[model samples]
Target: MTKQLILCDCLGSQSVDRAALSHATGLPCSRVHTALCTRAIDSAAKAISDGDVVIACAQEAPRFEELAAELERPAPLCVDIRDRAGWSEDGDSTAKMSALIAEARLAPPPVKTIDVTSDGLCLIIGPARVALPAAERLADTLAVTVLLLDGTEDLPLSRRYEVITGDLKRAQGSFGNFTLRLDRLRIVEPGGRGDFSLTAPRDGAETLCDLILDLSGTTPLFPAPHKRDGYLRADPGSATAIAEAVFEIAQMVGTFEKTLFLTLEEHLCAHSRAGQVGCTRCLDICPTGAFSPAGDSVTVDPMICAGCGACSSLCPSGAIKYDAPPVAHLIARIRTLSEAFRAAGGSAPHLLVHDEDHGAEMIALSARFGRGLPADVIPLAVPALAGFGHAEILAALASGFAGVDILPSPRSERDPITYEIALAAAMGAGDRVALLDVDTPDAMSDALYAQTSSAADSATDIAPVLLMGDRRQVARLAARTLMPQQDTPVPLPVGAPYGAVLVDGDKCTLCLSCVSLCPSGALLDNPDLPQLRFQEDACLQCGICATICPESAITLEPRFDPTDAAMSQRVLNEEEPFCCIECGAAFGVKSTVEKIVATLAGKHAMFSGNGTERLIQMCDDCRIKAQYHKDNNPMASRERPRVRTTEDYFGQRRDH
Candidate 1:
């Protein structure tokens, strides 16, 4: 059965035409309710009993879920159409509401996850005054150990938690599995006759714990501290911060689901080839230090990865991809929103992309206090805003969205987001794509509303293309669709994933060094002839070929080539083959052979004779035979010595 859409007008505050939505979405709609959370809740319960119903109100989702549990039913999918579209001040929000509903109907793929278990082993590192009190609160909940930074003078003995003093040498891992190394360590020897005494200081003490509460008041133990689970940091002087950290620490003591945010294809990674570094975008962009060089490609520690998704966006080869909801599903949602909006008589729709935390809250606040989103504006809430890369922005524009506006929160890493926007803009998007860095909800609303001009009229008619294959493939398809009339390749900014490899013909010697080191098979050598061939579409702009070139003949040109010529191999440099002197068989390059002869013909003693110098132009088999038969051949031997040992001695003795 088709899922029913149960919507509310919020006490007649917003208009929702049931007929228009039903026609636009082709889903059965319930009669508009004034108060779905109170008086009309029974109707919601009846609808919930049917299963596969979409609740149009997100604010009362908890109450509805609680009611569903009471009635022994699964929670219905809730989409906030009110704040997103219905409550907007723009007249006739039916088209926007329909688009939001259509997008919600897409069932996102199940998120991949791993179970992380914390057995409540906590390590507290701070001064005694701060660590002891925090450890005391967590003693009942967790197996606590306090590492005192200052001297343990006037300290009372305690059995509830072990106390120690050490300099934390290194801390690694995350959540349930943290490995720590401490130097100059001393453990409390409580069995002494006098007050508590510690053992002699030792170096390189190793320990393991499930959690770490760092109140050292110096520096964070890990980079991107806020993203590290089970590792909490707070200022030692701030009582409130310490208290909050303790309370949070006490609750993290069980198996939790950690989403596997990225999927890696090692073979596809262009990180390195033959020890030559190619693409390091992921390694450079990962803020949490989750990625490290394993061999040629990088490996990600699932336990430590914070899932900012900057790596996935920056990865040129599609080796690492965001997988919480998958890139395919995200594109499907974008396409659905664009298609449904136009189907419902909407024109020039702009997409507002934001994360669930900051952007959703901002939209909610705007709906309640100020004018909500415009009728032509649609909101897309992503798990991580940074995951939406240039491909997605282009997809939205190609799918009929007049423009795309990304709203990043204050906490989001702006560098990756800005780069992606710049990349998208460089690919013919121009001013159609923007990053809104407004702080307040009103400011966001004002900025969105102030935009009067729509994207170029050509964008409206461009039909959405099917987004198949990997990130690079999808990007190419979208770029092609965006500018179908343009026949030439689009010039992209430097460091773009798409590009061509340029070779200097004069400098190249057909050594085939670049072809051997190319990770993407973008560079190849002709078996029959000495030639360097390149496929521009396959070139990742990784610079491995350029770096591996012995002659320094290869260079990279970053651009997007949508023509068919990019798909096929094109010869970059070629030369006539040198024939064997004896058999006329093709061997090496003619130019290389002539150069070798010119340098070694008579100048070198080994090739002083005309016959010996001819060996330089011979094939492998011909060269070997000619060298063996030469008059002064190194393999030639004198007449063999006869057996004159025993017989000659006997004859001499007889003569005597």
Candidate 2:
């Protein structure tokens, strides 16, 4: 059943802070301000329902116009406790103070009463039941010499205060609701000067009212999905059922105004940076551009958002917190578990082994090496081959686990830079780390066997091992060879080997060793079939696929073949070439420049360094101008055809 989601927040010194409220409701502070600034246009009677109260905690006052509109239908009450001058016109003044004092005390005209000055203590509370305790604290502070004498009751009780007559006479009314009517009340002057009588409030109710009216007590609330309270229940189906359930649990709840689900335009503008107004990252990458910006806030077009959870995962500022478990919840779990795994196993030279193909090698390593060199070798297992790389690894870093051994198959389309980052992280934590290059099962098994033998013979310092290898098929081989009696293949999830390239059927041979070379989990093999799923999204298109495709079966499909724009540049030449510049000097490989220009030129326009840093050294001008012309302005030189000639090949001056 669809439940009515009520977002509630109390405006008092306790709980309900601004950040917590924003995080809980997934609404921007500005929008919340808009609601507050307009004042609660709708009445509590109109905005409340039997089953739902979506109490959105506002950073500022609610917009009166918008509140009235929200109140028209569902009667969603917008409560605005005047935090920080709802309008700002109510400044501190004496006339207003005298009027408020007269009203609250019910005293006759201009009766002078001074504070029996002791310490100017303040206590604040809200109308809610939880606020009474805070109110009582204020009474205690005011009665410095006097003590609080009351039973364990929720209601207010009478109390008396000790004061000095001389100090009380000096105190005078400063503003509305602030009065200095009593003269002999100052018990002990606050730690300041003796002459000045001005100070903050010292009464119980007045203290709370002052805090409430000034918006000082307003706090952001972070109401985690209260599963026990039934605020958030398991899905039963329609929105109606969910709403009904929520109403039953939280009576007198105020539902969200339908306008909260803003238009696509509104959502975009609100979410983007101020200067980059109308930026639509959600629209561009979101499978469904179901989000838009409203003013300075982004809102979800609930109908189109599909609750896919992608927007939440990719959002830079975490503006869009999702309710789904697939991404956000999984990400949190991965981080938590990865940390536990690392802490429990990070001592010895450890490798974080992944990939199903290396199951045999891991088993051999376990039998031969034993518990991974007597250290932690975290085997992050997953159902899908590439699923673990998305956010699990990231979470591991966040959880204080810096070192990781990436073990991928040679044939798997793994990226080295990805592993470099992991290695960097490990290095950052001062851990001995290594990316074990074992893509194929056989290679991995052999490598482990060799390592085991070497480890036994030598007294060498075995560095902390971060094994990144693919041990899928090797594990099967080990299971079959080592244990002939056993019928099942070793579970691939447990330190399975993977390769750079994998072949399903005879379309391609699983002979490529690129997977083993991959330092990161950029590429992984599918354990079920001989199939290989290239996470092209993760692949930098480094031509490692073409470099290690042993069978010549895998080719960098041209534009027409793949038809995907992201793969367009993958069609460039995979091989390098030696070219003679001006005086017959082989300046390095020509294809290297071509590759760099193709892949990174347009994308990394802002990179101050030249692409020549990786492979070869281009002439100073070529390197500098290459970035300026190609990266800085690809379209600027449309008049000149980008033609390759002898001079261009030789890195010499070309005729205009």
Candidate 3:
């Protein structure tokens, strides 16, 4: 059923062309309502009761949701057309509005989540003055334990919470399951004591808690401490900070839904092969220590992962994928927006990719106060802006967008974004993709408006490509579309995922060690001959094959080969096969066998014997048989001893 779009003019603040939007979006857009949340709320209620409606007002979404709940119906999908498009200072936002509506109509992927239950056990770490006060605030709501840094303070008579003196050695885990180790630990002995006296100090004392309130006024226990859910930290000297931390800590009890941000395909991981490290991009860039090496592949602790998505963006093999909404869904949104914009007579549309929190707020603020976004600019809200890697950027460009400008929030990781932009530029995007590091709404608007024209003239004419593959495949398709005229291979940055393997034939020796250890099957050996074959497109540029190569002949060249030759296997090195001396069957490489003969035939004592040098040139079966029959062979049988045991024993007994 076609969804009904409830359009609102927000009391005549912004213009809305119902007829034009309906024509462009192919949806039943109602007449513009001046007051959808006030006098005309009955219409919204009727639409909700009827089912399958899209409310075009995001500002009043809560009221509409409440109405739906009251009417015993599902909450309608909300799209903020006002803040994103209608209120734009640049005139004629009809095309932008259509694109926004069309993109919002697409079904969102279901979010995967795990239920985490916190039993309200809180650990407070700081001096007695800070820890005791914070513990008192949370004692009623949570089971509190105060770990006092200074034991010199006078003790309180009332035991509202357990008090202990210790130095926190280490802290691990996340929100609902924190594991802590303390050294020089001492527990307060309350019985028959005028003043609290601590027991004997001990080391390596371990405890578990559901949450931690750090008032130690020192370094945080976890990296990226703000990203940790149940861990709260505050300065001991600041009473306001302590109060805020205590209040936040009090509410963090009971069951909560945690998003499983990533999914791992173990077979596709290029982390390691045969104990040799292939790729450590995820481990290197992960802001939180969520990834750990597990045998050949890496394992992610979803509980500890803050979902910065640096790992997913840098992952070469799509082994670790951001799952809040999969990469395909994001691509689909980009395609839909681009196609819809073009259909509505929009040319040279630019994508403004930003995170949900910072980006959304900026757009809303710009529309309400400052000059709104330009008509040609379409805003795309992603869960993690860092996850918008080079492939996604290329995909937007190839799907008819003239350029892509990423707006990263203060919390977003900058290194990965910079690297992805650099990579995308190397693969034909050039200056078409960029990072907009604006602080405020006015700055964001100014930066976007400054780029009045499309990044490239060719971008407007390039036909869009269907993005239906993994990251690499999508990237290749986009690259081909972007650089249709260029026949030469594009040179990529040093650590690019796409590349070719260079082998020095003089040193390779047809050893085939690299082929065996290649995780992506990019390197292979020919069964018929001593050959090293490689498919350039299949190579991950992981450097595992080079690391495992015994001859140290293998090296990597980072470049994107767009031609068909990249898809097919080509010989890197080949040698004529050596024939067996006895059976004439091919076995090893001719040059390798001759080299062995030259090195050891006359000098080695074992090979100096008669017919022994010939053994080196023969096949395995022939060599084994020859060795069994050779003089003084270890396999030669000895003469058996006479067995007259019974007769000899009887003769000895008679003599006795």
Candidate 4:
């Protein structure tokens, strides 16, 4: 690694942890400066010029960047150790500050962008009397199409836009590619009633429109309609709201950058296995209708995804990864911050996670007005609350954070942050719901200051460890490593990713239905024998196996296994293989085959005869051959009576 200049800021509040910062960042004592903006700017110029700078202050980043550019120096990598670690009244956060800096050194991978080009093909969905005016405003910039839901429509003012009437059945997709399913469509004609005329209604219509200006305020066409891009709906009666919508809708005609938020590993998706539906967590939680069952797998439309990351959080398989930055980068930050704070001898550190918007505002206000955060508190700002899930939460605990607090977006009230906080607590991570859901900065400070006992906050020399592998792997590892230190894993809450599958061997018969349905390969089958295998660590406990098991022999037991056995593969059920009577090849389970024969023999017509009983013991090819031979044997054939009928009839007639 290149030798870098390290600058720590007291952030105009507290004393700097110069020694601890230097020790953690591996920079020499002389090179690391406190209040880098005030003192070290002139001295650090040479290092900045060489592109070897690490600024430990996020608040002054823009100023430093400008200064670096003016000095023809490379832009320095920046991290916030102030609000995150040092802003707290807890004196010198040398260890925590150092960790933040070290974490910042590891660069995040770049994200790919998807471009959505809109040609201004707008659809106005409202009563024509209301929708026509909104369409007129956008007619200049967009190729406007009016879809009237009612029969009475206003006459067109201009010939530029097309007007048609229909009821919108469903509307989906996003900017530059809106798809609408509409029916009961009729066109406007010159001769009918007071308003105008409508052609006879016809059903089943689909149109490809780039934008939708909704005024038919009946029901939204997409989930979380506000989150659906390029589709604007407002109160039909509010003139001001409608005007604002028109302005916003007009600007949506140009090309825009749509974040490729989700990285999909289609194969890892447990949505369906062998054409049987397995996991629908992503589908159930997606605020925007981005995921749809396509064949055996689900397809996610990046264009339609609102980036809530609920899908990623609830995803049993790590098939859906929110890559605003990859999980590794986030985990790296968590590890570094936790380890650094501990290294500097900080005790019972609280990881305060917030986003860049209101959360940031509260931190700033709290610092200036209310009691600044306690020294043990460290702040981490993410793009959104959804970006980090239980994996990151438990990773914080495993890394030795005493507690976790999150400041979520306002819409979080509708359901986002609180739900996530509950999940974290269920996994044995200290619940910071009060701090996260607090209404004011002062209340936030009060909440932080009020904290007393954090069961896992004790300082232990757990070296910073990066979480690896998939979501379940990380979550399992965190629970094993941290929950033991805080508490022990018992029965996790419902929907938890841990637990074992209980199988009744008497009823199982080694059918392997559970094995086939398991998406995580938790339940595996031995090809050479009739056996079902399970790895507790891999079992997401989605109940896919239990749901699909035909014999009703499998049941889910949701419990946390902290021992090595959780990961080791074990036989859930095994039975003797039923060998084919003809080729002697193992095919079915002996018990299952016998059970089937016992149930069917003398009851079903096909299995009644003793000769036919041999068919069950033979392989498919042998059964076909045996049946062919038996039907064609001369001894087995009934004597033919066909040609005697005509001769016998003529002889009988002559005798009479």
- The candidate maximizing lDDT is 3
Model 2 C-alpha lDDT versus the unseen true structure? 0.32
Which lDDT tens digits does candidate 4 get at residues 516-586? Answer: 67888898988888788998878877777888888889888767777777778999888888888888888
What local distance difference test score does each model get? 0.89, 0.32, 0.91, 0.74
Answer with 2 or 3, whichever has the higher TM-score: 3
If the candidates were sorted by their lDDT against the true structure, best first, what order would they fall in? 3, 1, 4, 2
- Per-prediction TM-score: 0.94, 0.20, 0.95, 0.79
As a TM-score, model 1 comes out at 0.94
TM-score of 3: 0.95
lDDT of 3 at 161: 90
- TM-score winner among the candidates? 3
When 1 and 3 are scored with lDDT, the better candidate is: 3
Model 1 alpha-carbon drift over 4 Å, by segment: 452-459, 605-610, 627-656
Q: How many angstroms is residue 134 displaced in model 4 relative to the true structure, after the best TM-score fit?
A: 6.0
Misplaced by over 4 Å in model 4 are 1-24, 27-73, 78-90, 93-96, 123-166, 181-207, 215-218, 234-247, 413-435, 452-466, 483-489, 526-530, 574-656
Candidate 1 C-alpha lDDT tens digits along 1-656: 68899989999999999999999989899999999999998899999997678998989999989988998988888888899998777889989888988888787799889999999999999988889989888999999999988878956566899998888989999999999999989888878587888899999999999999999888898998999999999999999999999999999999999999989999989999889998999889888999999788999998888888899888988999999888988999998998899999998899999998989999999989998888888999999788899999988888888899999998898999999898888776778889999999999888888873434565577776677777778878887878777678778878889899898999999999888888889999988888889998889899988888888998888888777888999999999999897998888899999999999999999888656788898999998998888777789899689878988999999999
